[model samples]
Target chain A: MSEVTRPTLSDALTERMLELIRTGGHRPGDRLPSTRELSQRFAVTTPTLREALRRLEATGAIEMRHGSGIYVGADIERLVLPNPNMREIHAAQLLELLGARIVIEPPLAALAAEHAGGEELSALQRVLDEAGRHLRGEDAELHDANMTFHRATARMAGNSVLNEVVDSLLTVHGPEQREILQIFDDRRRDYEEHLAILEAIEARDAAQAESRMRAHLVDVKTVIEHRLQSPR
Target chain B: MSEVTRPTLSDALTERMLELIRTGGHRPGDRLPSTRELSQRFAVTTPTLREALRRLEATGAIEMRHGSGIYVGADIERLVLPNPNMREIHAAQLLELLGARIVIEPPLAALAAEHAGGEELSALQRVLDEAGRHLRGEDAELHDANMTFHRATARMAGNSVLNEVVDSLLTVHGPEQREILQIFDDRRRDYEEHLAILEAIEARDAAQAESRMRAHLVDVKTVIEHRLQSPR
Candidate 1:
């Protein structure tokens, strides 16, 4: 048998500290207990506790403010992948990405309807109103508006990890939508779908919100499929 | 407005090369064109091409072997997060993670039943038999076997990105599983459900595979919920 190497004391403490942050009823920007207190609680020396805190800081799971105290940073659970370059995306890849979004987003919309607070609901309303104005205008930035609407809906779902994954998926969806920009000629239909989804959200109708979102994606998918089938 | 700095020549070349890797007919382990040939094709100097190659290597999208030509590595699409430290997982977090799996895995099972080959199906059957032996012997390595079963199902789905994500999910599932190991008292029932799901896959019944997988997860979720509600 190969030799076993035990984990260093600091490494174990770092994991314990991270666990506390995750389940310790602490939010972002919440202060951690002082070094002296932490050391006593863990029954370790002050230097060892400081070593653990230093490691946590490196993982983006905690922040040490000079003279104030240690506070939680955005943390590992919040790290998102870099935005993918759209010019590099292939049609098949984009379609696969959209298929993934189709699977994930409707459920997210349902969760949003079940979870959104007044603040999140108003944020959704603001995005919808802005998107509507853009759709009505002659020089509309419809792509950005559409992305904003979906991203906002993701945020309303209240699961940080899911919200981040949806954002990454949209990095592909945003560009693909742009590639098929001309197919969204039915501006009124697009606007009404957005409004319907928003109304379902506002009414706290989870099932309706889910179905509306799914229907919207299916429409977009059909346009994309048509574009892929026909040559430019 | 911030000052606009144009991307360096190497950065542009890197993006172009990555684009080639994505859209090019190159699969993992396929040899890339010679550096001299590629530089000539792109009209870029050799140093710029080398810099770009370096970047791709760093991103894990390609590999370089001494005395041999450059080859496509595993690519960005296959990178999965490391297994999490389960000692840090909380009951609520485990429940939420299980819920995410419930939402995602049934569809994956359906996809798998559509895509699995004779070899893949046989591999799955082998895993089930091994797990059953462990259960019958009362020396069960249930956790590893359970993960192997789900991960194999994910692989059979034939979606690289989804498979990678499922692997990462199993990282959490693997360890949280150990924490709740006691609740799995009905090992025979667990084995039977897996067999049922595998039978659906072997029969190529996508809908039945999906429903069976969903029912299995719901059972696991119920167990987790019961555990969370009552203390030992």
Candidate 2:
């Protein structure tokens, strides 16, 4: 088991796989050659090929379905990604994540206010409406709805890279954010704050939207800080 | 080659490996069990264990030195990461990347101004001096120096997560950014704008630092946009 395999071969194989995808003009969801064909083509053993495939799978460059086949992953084109290996976040990291949101998301809300179109605004309204129903329901569903509102607002800002950044932040801290929902206590206030931000965006009031977003995140951060310090 | 190996086994093994690290309190750079030990502990074959290891290694959760044993990867705790498989970025993404920097980096400059200590400010000055030396020198060296300036400023802003975010953006765009250095073509102006930003940060003028950072990024974006539109 401690046999010295050439790690460089695995690396070069991964690069060649990427080159194959690029040269073939394969898009996400497109299928690639089966394992046998690929192994033969690359002249590597099954285990070696699997090593490269697993690497690509982990980073979301490709996906391997059990009985199905391999396809390019949806996240292959994304610039940033939530660390899939981040199973848990510490209290300090969670706060830093929120601090990041404090700096990045508010201006996105302002951009949302400035640029979101009619259909997009209506879509955002629908997301909040879903959250409204989940207000008294399962924490998981409510958490998801809340996350959706944040993601939707960021997307409506019309900058794909910023949207990716916010999405990645929200994703990696997801479990802790659910814990945050339980700790923060005032569910109604959370819902109302999101509504207020949405209203600002719908009203096309960029300044109001930006300030409201900042205030809302600051409120969450304040609560979390107090809770962390006083952990009853 | 497409033998029906249990994909579920690989997934579970990956989870267990992460658990092993967490339960053992293994920090980044700490060595993990060897391949032989891991195989015995997890009760899996070499191929199966290798798949799991490859996945973790791809995501920077672990490192597998060729002759040396396994070790915890330095990026194990990062919340966000640049896409390792991103071999090429399209022109549109390049512009959007610039747009994102314009939004995220300026406020960080202001924070750097407000919070950076004397030592940190001097370190930043040193980074700029390095860039000045490289301006008339190698493209790769100058590119590295310029990136260091951005990364150092982001770090000085004192938010680890934002620092990670900025670092990821820069990492994924390294090749294109080098190309940007050549196309933007005003090496002296690029160096001077960086100097002015450092001056503002050193002067503790948060507003000036913020505005200057924004203007500098906008200048780069303007040059890129003009070149893309005309491409002579």
Candidate 3:
């Protein structure tokens, strides 16, 4: 899908504005040109200019003050995902989330196996040990340990963007995982799965690590599916 | 990691606020209690209550009017991912995006095979047809056709959240895809791959569909990686 194309006036203007920021000539608080001046410069209408500015503002690239003018807001490179309501999530959404994990984590685990060094391996071990201590308790510490283990493995994968995506998705599942942990007796199995993933990564067995991680997430999806089917 | 535990004061208070919003007693524009009133009701300090309120606001649960009050802004059910800078994306980031796609699209294709009906299948066919027409054009129209084909596949997967996530990620790569298409002559290969995926979906061969999708994305990743290694 690699092909460059023509842009609409608003899109062109938005690109021009972003290009101006990217040159590092404009600081975060620097004001952009007024709508009138910008429209004249870009040969567009004020409404078109405003539309472009509004698009930038929505992206956190720039901001408009009620009485003042538009100014550069943030660097605009940092990506952020919206939060899903944990309390309001339905069974279908839960499956979708798990399905996403099932697809992502196995690849990430393989990457971890290929890329993980001693430090990352030790970090995974630390989290696994912590998880072991909390295995028998239906407590927040265990939940935290579980979250940390997955996140630590993502860290081991050494891909910042992948880590961010996984982190955000795990945050969505946080409360639900807690709820499930309290109601179901699955911590031992989960811990075993975590250990197996760690072992594969430590052994630098990318395929095994990938398959184990996929299997672990499948177990999670199964438990969640059963719970959703017979909501207790 | 199925473990539920006690909530912090702020966590408990946030749940209370979300509960009020969820009960349908408070509509989207309804005002939440003032800081003092809410803190008093929850028997917590105003700071503690405000912390909870800020958390809620971050999730799009409510909006705080500077001098007025907090009001329900939107339901906290939506998920939005920020668009990446396609024009300025480094090769590494492009590969990361492709890697993400490799994980996602295969499973999505499998699901589409299992779930897509006649209408969705026809939609996929239509996009594929459009893509075929654009195969020789190094223009934005071709980019749109390529994007629409993949998005149609996601739609056929019949998962709203998955569809949204894939759409946003593809949007991130849209311009870059255009640039690559303009620079490369691989459109025929891409079209053939798309046809294979479509054929698998049409035949209700989930495994075949998934493998085809994954292989196609892996090819994309390899091309981008080689290009990054030897920039043309």
Q: Best candidate per lDDT, number? A: 2
Q: How close is candidate 3 to the true structure, as a TM-score?
A: 0.70
Residue B97 of model 1: what lDDT? 68
Q: Give the alpha carbon lDDT tens digit for every residue of B45-149 in model 2.
A: 888899999999999999998888899999999999999999999889999999999999999999999999999988888888898888899999999999999
**Which candidate, 1 or 2, would have the higher TM-score against the true structure?**
2
For model 1, the TM-score of its B chain against the native B chain is 0.66
Instruction: Put down candidate 1 lDDT per residue, B75-176, tens digits, no spaces.
Output: 445423322223455666667666667776888899999999999999999999889878855433876787799999988987755665567666645656
- lDDT order of candidates, best first? 2, 3, 1
Give a tens-digit lDDT track for model 2, residues A74-105. 89899999999999898999999999999999
Q: After superposition, how far is residue B231 of candidate 1 from its true place, in Å?
A: 4.0
Q: Write the per-residue lDDT of candidate 3 for residues A1-232, one digit (tens) a residue.
A: 1111112544577788788777857767888776666778788755455545655654457766665676887536544354534465666777777777787788899999999999878878998898898877647999999889888888778776667677777776677767767655667888898999999999999999999999999988887788778877
Candidate 3 docking band: incorrect
Is 2 or 3 the stronger prediction by DockQ?
2
Best by TM-score: 2
Stretches of candidate 3 exceeding 4 Å from the true structure: A1-21, A25-87, A136-138, B1-76, B84-87
Residue pairs in candidate 2 whose N, alpha carbon or C atoms collide under 3 angstroms:
none
Each prediction's TM-score against the native?
0.68, 0.98, 0.70
Which ranking of candidates, highest DockQ first? Answer: 2, 3, 1
DockQ of each: 0.10, 0.74, 0.13
